[model samples]
Target: MDTTTAPDRDDWITTPLTAALLRGALELERTGHGLLPHRLPARARAQCTDPQLAMVESQPSGVRLVFRTRATAVELDTLPTKRNYTGAPPRPDGVYELLVDGRPAGRGSVTGGNTLTIDMETWASDYRPGEPGTVRFDGLPGRAKTVEIWLPHNETTELVALRTDAPVEAVAERGRVWLHHGSSISHGSEAAGPTSIWPALAASLGGVGLVNLGLGGSALLDPFTARAMRDTPADLISVKIGINLVNLDLMRLRAFGPAVHGFLDTIRDGHPATPLLVVSPILCPIHEDTPGPGAPDLEALSTGRVRFVATGDPAERAAGKLTLGVIREELARIVRERAADDPHLHHLDGRELYGPADHERLPLPDNLHPDAATHRLIGERFATAVFGEGGAFAEGGTSSPSAD
Candidate 1:
């Protein structure tokens, strides 16, 4: 376990963290310490200086290292950027999940990494650099097997080193690629671990490879994001829209419709015939009818529990203000109109993934993101809805849904 710096352990084989062994990241940047995975490409990242986008895009939601190894012991050195709120309870260390031949093998966490302290009220942030830490997994079967280490979906990590008792090589790509884009819910906000994130879970169940671009508080239908999706190679694609737009109060209905059309058009430019599914936001009591900009409940924060509330007026809908309800209706219409000519285009009401009944059974702890259990529920439902028989991504299933 202490072998990260133990020079006497000459049997330890160090492997370079190369792109061949990595999956789900659009680009990997050379950092001062090591390699930092980026969900968005350098071009997309340069278009925005928003700190929130910068942070979430680098969180590596569905990023993982896949390799074929006969090693019984593995160690990875990492420098993780952990977040802390000024007035809220500290978050736990992010978990690194290991899978052996596509099954859960082990889980570990690194300690002593960089910290970013954010003031929720002022939206100001401070950073403190720290030393790198090591995560180790031992006692694995010595036989050859495919191994995957899923990075923390909520933390930005820099891969510093990889060492194992035996040499490791990259694994060949497998399964269909499913590229998805959405907000923090799809970003694994409150999920227990990276593998447990809804998209990851759904991909696993659907037997597909996942490339997640679910940036937190940053999925505002940006052109760069749509372009990124456009250029990325994938057999299947889905965009979970509405939540971030409504919560951010980024645009009115007039802008939202055209923006969505433009986003899809850019994607279609690159993948004109790819199966593209447009999904609306799930049921969110706060923003279902009420418009947003969503605000943090300062009162709840005082008790160390983070909560959110919609701040915009429902009456503003007359002014073309967007709400979850309005967004869903618009998304359905757009998909219906587009699908008439594009047989591969389809729409799925997100409520099918998490609806009012499901909400009653398992309310969102923060009035926003789903809890771990709900994430699983959403994932299972998504797998069936999008990848099951007659679903959009199903084999020989090209017919679009009539309504969302």
Candidate 2:
């Protein structure tokens, strides 16, 4: 802790950070290098073996630095580790969205931090740690205002320090907190920017706070993740299921039903009456009828990109293999059964956000995740379906004891 809020212009005042400003992240650890934010709490993280979960959770997809300041100029030093798949296009610099007074103000980018490159062909990995970089912003309103710096949603960001011309203080938020969990699609897979991700966009449109647990390739309905959701304080909750299960072929229909029940039960243990929405998968033709064990299209990778393909046979569904269509039907049935005694439980067909018709116009570029425009479309649909007037989960809106 620095006692000096010494503000004289050129002297960069170091602002102290607290729990109030950091959103989405579960905990902040002060390391010798800087402050690292973890999406899953220590206990939860300790129970997971999959490295993919570890990566996406720490990426800080919906995390940002929020504070109130009158400084005309500000600088945030951070080290961002961008994920890269071998034989794929290199990702652009992580974007920093600077919002002032709840409005788009400016933007910044930090380059040269670190890269975690994976060779999907060989399942080998390489890590390169780079130097810390700074994202500087100037030309502010020069008046005390709430400012939010949304970090890169697709990269793991380690915040180094905050330097502002004036002292900074955390602002108390005023909105219902929405805790959301889903797969990579919800993790802003192909979204345009950090804030442009569907969840972030929906939160902005719905006038609510978002704690996105959209772990890419990691939303496996793990008990620990459910615990994370249970412990977190939230007024609204949603879990998008299906794609990850189909892609990983983690379990059969018999196991899927019980897992979903257990997931909801754990959350209800902490939040018995919070409005809970269970959403199924959107239209992914490859996985809709076919089972998976999704695999990367080697041909597409040779062209310097990553594309996914369903490898399992549709007929295999007869033997208890999971498919998007199968998961959707099961989720709806489970939600309906549970709602008999739990009036707060609700169900949503993910297709309602992006169905077959929408797929024709806005196709999933990689045949797995929606592209940028689709992200916007899905976000808009979710805002209307869940938060609009008379919507099921809308604040103070009508509550139905059945799936919609």
Candidate 3:
């Protein structure tokens, strides 16, 4: 076959082919085309040769895995700097398989190792509830032909698998930047599926990329996190604040206002002209406007004794502190005032992403994190809000849904 001549599309069906025959002749091409809308995988330059399953994972870390023929070249593009997918039940020690040339070539693991080796920590073995761990792939045979990467079974993750007949090579491409910071909802909690999380969903919908800086229980306007956001690169940005602040009773209104201002200031230091959107929390009754720092009632957990009646104390909210509604209004006001001087700044009500209508239809089981269906709703809203024609999105064009 001539290497330069394009194959006739109809010729694909001209010959009798078997499963093994197809796998042997195909080359899994790895061109980093980046993601599309609807939380689908990025478009491919060409159809992969020995293509296999395309999976998404949040275990160990948020990554897309592609297995292919002869592991000679590797290039991972579109790394999220802000918030990478993290597991709910932290993974302790496990073996991940790497298949090469249609066979198992090597393996990677998280067993005995430093806690902070891969810029993460290990908590428990059976999927630690919220502990971050690193997954490293080392030791490869020079002549290996195939690879299979394993993910933590206890936790949900995202991935894309591939198999090729040619040497694997990495393709480089500059992707659009999306900087996002939110509570556990944004961190992929209790979500139906890893790839269905709101952030991932929205990223796919907008056809842009992101740096997820979502912390499980740590979205309390932390200066460290703000500093981290300030230090990162972003073409477009958003901050989903309030739920964690209210739930944790981390700050009062006096502290909350200034903290929010400071957080935006920090981010603006680097993303001066980028389109900045500030998003507040969705509906959550317990911490809507109450002082919580609410911990699960041990009594409820121990003997299943007390019911939901004793879960949270709502009196603190009456004393005046940060509530999701309060935060939403403040965020809108602050951005408006700031927008007078910085037109690029934007504000989005969290409810607009998933509000009362959604609750009336699909109530969040925990009254906090949204499910996969909600993620889809929110992702569609985001896509239409910014990327749609005449929408606020800076990139103006027909939105392309990322459908792999």
Better of 1 and 2 by TM-score: 1
lDDT of 3 by residue, 1-404 (tens): 11233223332212111222111001122323322111111232122221111111122212223343333322221211112212222433433444443245444443332222111122112222232233433344445344434332213321222323234433222468676777667766655443456665677667765556555665667665666667666777788888877766667777877888898898888878777777767776655555556554344435532222113455655566666667777777777778777767777777777777788898876556676687778877877776667555647432222111
Return the lDDT, model 3, position 284: 69
Ranking by lDDT: 1, 2, 3
Candidate 2 Cα deviation (angstroms), residue 187: 0.8
- Give the lowest summed-lDDT range of ten residues in model 1: 1-10
- The TM-score between candidate 2 and the true structure equals 0.96
* After superposition, candidate 3 runs with Cα above 4 Å error: 1-62, 65-166, 297-315, 397-404
The candidate maximizing lDDT is: 1
TM for every model, in the order presented, reads 0.97, 0.96, 0.61
For 227-317, candidate 2 gives per-residue lDDT tens digits of 9999999999999999999999999988999999999999999999999999999999999999999999999999997889999998999
| Pairs in steric clash, model 2 | none
Local error of candidate 1 at 192, Å?
0.4
For candidate 1, give the lDDT of residue 310.
Answer: 98
Alpha-carbon lDDT, every model: 0.93, 0.88, 0.51
